[model samples]
Target: MEETSSATMKAAVGKDYGEIRDMVEVVDDQPRPGTPREGYLVVKVLACALAPGDNRVLSGRTKMVQGPPAFPYVIGGDVCGVVHEVGENVEGFKPGDCVVARFFTAGPRGGLAEYYEVKATLTEHKPKTLTPVEAASLASSGTSAYIAVENTIKEGQSVLVLGGGGGVGTMLVQLAKRKKPSFLAVTTAAPKVVQDLGVADHVINYEQENWWEVAEITDQAPFDVIIDLGQGVSAWKVARKYNLLKSRGQFLTFVGDHHVLWAQGIFQIFQSMGPPLWRSAWTPCIPGVPTFRWQLDGLPDKREPLTNLFKLVDEGGLRVVLSNGSPFPFTTDGVQSAMEQLATRKAHGKVVVKVAEE
Candidate 1:
């Protein structure tokens, strides 16, 4: 081993919020791995997904970027990569394991790098049906939907997915059907895709502006279960329309922080009429049954939530849309166009960036 044993890595680095191309600089020799060198494992990052969050994190609109250990950060969350090196004392996973993960706290310095370190638990084996980029897209949206359906729902209940054409909505609409919900509906901006999935018994397009008039989801009045993984006010309005009291309904959304989630949970305690349930849901960092290939945070195989989901995908319960085209490459020059395209959300599915040839 060379004395210092420092290795070079490529990352999309930035100091300020701007277009991905304008701010990203590919510098050489930025050192391979950092401390916790004991538990840490370095992955040769392959493909990552682009979402609206990337724009927010990069532009500082989301206020998600934390202090220090910040800036010059790579802005990506959904990722899939092959194991290049493993820290000593780390067991279960070996070099070359391909894992999927969400680099939540780490940011660009996190998933977007050509190589990055991850705790073993966040990664899982890619579903056989998915490519790297498609698998990467599953972390936040796929798993959140999985958790929502499994945890909060019951069979023969009426369900609605607000902002239905989104990644989460796409998965939720399908997975919720697995429970044989009585009524399943999804709302989206795209009318055609809603028609194509056929998972939703009813589909409403928000683009029409008159969308709400026909969106009266129930003739009997209000849905039994509501999953709102979209905007906040929109969620509150829909909840008021369809939610029933004393019926034990489940509402899922991205609303609420640590405090808000607990507070909303309390309202469910006192109200006889269903007082709104503010869903503050997160994708599991752990793997579930059927065993995924990649493990981060801990042994990859040890995580149950992710592995369980894989089994579902394998069994045809969970579905991830694999978009056409090669993943956008992970180079400094190409990223500008990728980020610009990401902003448009014109692409039918999650945009992928291929970091390294696998």
Candidate 2:
């Protein structure tokens, strides 16, 4: 085991904020996982999932990486790997244990590298039935989707998820399906793919039919809840135009509540620093409609949220959709290719990068 101290590992590192290829480079001299500080453990990564937020970070679009960051930083959020070492303060885990983690803190974001460090509090043992790829896909997107649904949705209500074919949308579909809403619909170019998930009762093909023009979506509108997992502000336009949300219906967007502010980096950075209280300062231009985004700090307990999701998987109640029906190999090219797919938002489900053979 001492030999681990002398090992060098391959890692996809971000040298600057720009295009994926230009900003990211694969390097082999990266140091291997070493002994962790208290409350943390080292895991030899097996798989890591590509997140859209990562693309934003890579493109220098987000403030999450605000302040001067050291060069050659690695950015990844979700991973599943084998424990290689543990700190004295860490409990309930030991070397060789399979675990899943979501590490959102700064500094060489541990996920894209062959060896990663995760806080014990944010880690959970992988469920017995899931493959490492499946486990890796759940941390960031899964938790975001779960937090969105858990906080806003109520039983027997009508719900609509835009961009239902993407990673977070896919997880939102599965989690929402378990709630058994009165009526469920999703907007996607590939209606058949969403239908195959058995999560949506009505699949509206946004490519072929205007959301307001489609009877399947409109009839079910004035919904009790609308989860906007889509990319742009078009969904908000549709929601306001069609009076799609009930007076008290909750509208949740992963793109942030005041997404337009995102275009204004200064204001976005200000709001990003706080709890988005700025939203309350101005009323929605469209009265009687409520819209909000998931707050990073307000999310439910990390370990339990994922543990419950994994329980759903173990019970055969949930499924994770991977891009192209397979995991991308753990290599520089593979990581870049996966990031590019996520940037297009065309991926059917979460894009997972296989880091090592399990």
Candidate 3:
């Protein structure tokens, strides 16, 4: 790895975990990342996408699981940038190469900085068709969607995506569409935007009516797969109560009742895993219970899925959906606003912050 002249750089710094507006501020004195360690690259960040996990860390909601962040922590995960330096044992990437990556193991010390050190395994060449903001938006959410759709949806099956207007949800809808489901539906507040994608057979405005009661959706009850991006187990309970899943269908969720788990302390975290494990073990024996699953964002290898995502983009089969007023300026107020918007959990799509020009 090569050395850079600057010893410090500007970054969105979180002084402590509490509130987005109260905790985060832009500072110029943060130490610039030095040489990339082995199998890592130092990225000159162009943009960073904000996610609910960033807010969770900033607000201390994930403290129990993640532990307290180091003070003046830089919180971001999804990053698009030019490689500034490459470490020994790394290949296929070099300085000045545009890339997108997720700092899945970096925790709070992540890509909100001017320069971020990322594992080469988590990085991919940025698709030519995507802008810095779009590329930044792809890593975390895109990979999650890719994993979910690849593992769950099958051809000729009926599918329903909860929170289909969200970052991961949008990607799931697009990827699932290619599977050619017999019936496809989504529940979202931004029905117009999702409907315009021309994938879903029915778009249920979850705000306007109960999705389960909507005639179009009810008629398609017993969905072959239910992918929940945000509703968590609440949606699962509803699906079970209403018999909305096929006997052998799958219910996949990316979010969990972590607040409850966190409140119960570390011991209960292990204890709480019991129900999901027990359900997984017994669901096949039960008559109507769909296989219940909890999906986490961490992936063993992100490179292949990211490459596939870029291919989808290049092929015009996928796109990054940004929320309104996104690509927020990279500043104290800008990052604060972005985090707040993500906290609402109502942003129609991904929220991104522009850190530098391409």
Tell me the whole-model lDDT of each prediction, alpha carbons only. 0.60, 0.75, 0.83
**Compared with the true structure, what per-residue lDDT tens digits does model 1 show for residues 1-358?**
1112356666666657666767866555456665436766777777877665566566654342232255666667667888778787677777888887665362333677767787666667777877777778776556666766776668988776766666556777788888898777777776676667778788777666543356455452356666665544455454555442113444455432111221123343234112332121111222221100111111122346677777788777555654334377666766666667656654445567777666
All-Cα superposition RMSD per candidate: 8.6, 3.4, 2.7
TM-score to true structure, per model: 0.76, 0.89, 0.94
**What is candidate 2's local distance difference test score?**
0.75
Per-residue error for 102 in candidate 3, Å, reads 0.3
lDDT of 1 at 121: 65
| Most lDDT-accurate candidate | 3
TM-score of 2: 0.89
- Regarding TM-score, does 2 or 3 come out ahead? 3
Per-residue lDDT of candidate 3, residues 251-354 (tens digit): 98777533233422667665656666566668868876788877864576649988988898998867678988899988899988988888887888899999
Candidates ranked, most accurate by TM-score first: 3, 2, 1
Q: What is the lDDT of candidate 1?
A: 0.60
| Count of steric clashes across candidates, in order | 28, 0, 0
lDDT (C-alpha) at residue 288 in model 2: 71
TM-score of 3: 0.94
